[model samples]
Target: MKMLRIISYAGLVAVAIMLLVAMCAILEDSVISHRAHRQELTGSTLSSPGLDHFS
Candidate 1:
């Protein structure tokens, strides 16, 4: 019974760590995508004369 309890606790910890890692990966991807989008917008704005009228 004691061994079972220990194993269960270990499994839970492993699952928690995996979930945290997955969340970090998702967040990293989101940040990268956001930066890429911003860069593309910046590039477009720089190349377009009409956007200057809006500013």
Candidate 2:
């Protein structure tokens, strides 16, 4: 019984870690897309970096 409980806890922890990682990945993607959109709106170009720094 003790072994089964430990196994279940371990499985839950693994799932929690997976979900955390997936959330981070999704957040990063949205942030990147947002930055790209902002750059387009502001006409910021690669030749001059940090133009969006003020924004």
Q: Scored by CA lDDT, what does every candidate get?
A: 0.76, 0.81
lDDT of 1 by residue, 1-55 (tens): 9999999999999999999999999988987776567668777524345533322
Candidate 1 wrongly placed segments (more than 4 Å): 44-55
Worst 10 residues of 2 by lDDT: 46-55
Note the clash tally of each candidate: 0, 0
Could you give candidate 2's per-residue lDDT for residues 1-55 as a string of tens digits?
9999999999999999999999999988987887888768779655245454533
- Kindly report the root-mean-square deviation of model 2 from the true structure over all alpha carbons: 3.3
Question: How high is each candidate's TM-score?
Answer: 0.78, 0.80
Best model number under lDDT: 2
lDDT of 2 at 46: 58
RMSD of each: 7.7, 3.3
